[model samples]
Target: MRQSYQDWKGQSIEAKRSQLRGETKDLPVPVHIQKEPPFWDVFPENPEVFKLVVQARALGVLRLEENRNTEEKVIRYTRETVIGSENVEIASSWEEAVQVLEVLACRPDKEAIGRQVSAKLADADQAQDKLGLYDQFINYLKQREAELEKIGGSDSPDYKREATIIKDLITSENLQLDNKSKLSVIQLVISPEKPLVDFIEEPHISNISPVEPPFMAGANVFCTECGEQNPARSKFCYNCGTRLVKPN
Candidate 1:
C-alpha cells in the first residue's frame, strides 16, 4: 500500500495539480480541520488523518488521495508534502482511523506522526473558511427567518436572533463564536435539504454552546455568562471563566 501511494505522489504541487485537473477530480483540502461529519467526513472522517493532511499542505506538500473504487474501499493517499513521501490508510470508519493513526503516532520519527503535528495551526487562509461558509449559512437562515416571520413560526423562537448574532459577528469581528455552533451552522447550511419545519429547530451545537476560540487577536470576544469583554484569543473570561465568544 505504501509503495502504491509512493508511486502516485507527483513530483510537485503543479504535478499534483495537473493530475487533479486531468483525472482524479482533485479537491482542495484546506487547513481548517472539520469536526463534524460528511463535509468533514467527505474527505476523511478521522481527525488524525485530516490533521495530517492539513499539516502536509502547510509544509508545501499535500497528499491528494483517489478512491477509485468506493465499493472496494481503496483509499490511495499519495502524499503531497515537502518531504519525499509518506502514506497511511485511514481505514473504513473513524474508529478504525483512530486505531490507524494511533499506531502511526507510536512509530519512530520517520513515521508520519511528528511531521503531522509539527506544522503550523491553520489560519483564515489555509484552513476552510468557517466564517465565510457561515456567511452563506446566515443568508440561508435569513431567508428562513423572513419566511417564518410571515407565518409567526413557533419552532424557532426568534430566527432573527441568529441573524442578529451573525450580523454582529460580521461587523464587530471580535465576537466570541462557538466552534460547535460553527460546525452545526455549516452542517445545516450544506445539509441534504431538510423541511422548513426541521430547519426551524435550534441547531444541535447551539445547545452545547461550546465557546469559539478566536483565530486572531485585536478583537474583544465577550463571555457568554457574565458578558465580560475578553480578548479574541481568550478562551475564558478573566473575571467569569465563562466561555468567550468568536474564539478563545
Candidate 2:
C-alpha cells in the first residue's frame, strides 16, 4: 500500500491528467487496511496481539493465521513494524476469533471497545471505515431494543434504555466525526443508489439522525425546498409545512 501511494505520488501532473482522461493506464490507488469484523471486537480478548497489530498498522503490514496444535485455540499474527517483522500469538484460533468478533460487533458493549480502539489507531485514516461498523452496530442495537421490549414485557423499560444510550453515543459522536466518514457510512448502510447530495441535503434519509443543521449547533430539520430549518423533533417544517422525514 505504501509503495502504491509512493508510485502514485511520483507521477507527474501531465501523467495523472492523461490517466484521468483515459489516455493512459489508470493510476494506482492506495489499498486501505480493514479487518473483516474489526479488530476491536476480538482483540480485547488478547491485548498483546492487539497492541502488536496497532503498531504494525503504522508500518502497513498485517497478516493473520490460525494457530494449530495449541492446547487452546489460538490466532497467530505477523506484523511489520519499525523494529522489524514480528510474529505474535493470541489464545484464539481464526474461527474462534471470528465468533467472538461477531458477538461483540452485534452487542452494545462494542461501542465502548470500538471507541477505545479508534482512539488508539496510529493512522486515523485506517479507522475511516469504522463509521460503517458503528452504523451496523446501531442497527443491531435498535433491533435488540425492540426484541427486549417484546421479551421483557413492560416490566423492564430501563433495560432497553441502555441500548438507546449506546446508540446515541455512536450516532452523536462516532458516526458524526467526519463528513467523509458519514458519507461512507451512508453509502454502506443507506441505499447506495440514492445520490449522496440528496442524503446530505436531506439527512433524515441518511439513517444517522437527528442531524444538526450546519448553520446551527443542535439537531434540526432543514427543508430542502423551502429552506426552513425546524427543531429536531418536529414532524413537519414549521415554515413550509413539509413533512420531515425520519429513518425507519
Candidate number of the best lDDT: 2
Clashes of 1: 17
Error of 1 at 42 (Å): 27
lDDT of 2 at 52: 31
With a 3 Å backbone cut-off (N, CA, C), the pairs that clash in candidate 2 are 74-92, 75-92
lDDT of candidate 2 over 84-197, digit per residue (tens): 964444224333332233332222222333444445332333335555445555555555456567668324654344454454545544544455456555455544333333
Question: Pairing residues by index, what is the TM-score of model 1?
Answer: 0.23
1-248, model 1: which lDDT tens digit per residue? 44332233212232443563465655344333463334322223344444443333223333335455334342224345587654433434423333344333323322544444333223333113545544454555656566687666424745544454445434444323465445454465643422111122244544433343344556787667787676666565655455555852
Candidate 1 lDDT? 0.42
Each prediction's whole-model lDDT (CA): 0.42, 0.44
Error of 2 at 48 (Å): 15
> In model 2, what is the error at residue 173, expressed in angstroms?
4.9
Clashes of each: 17, 2
- TM-scores across all candidates? 0.23, 0.26
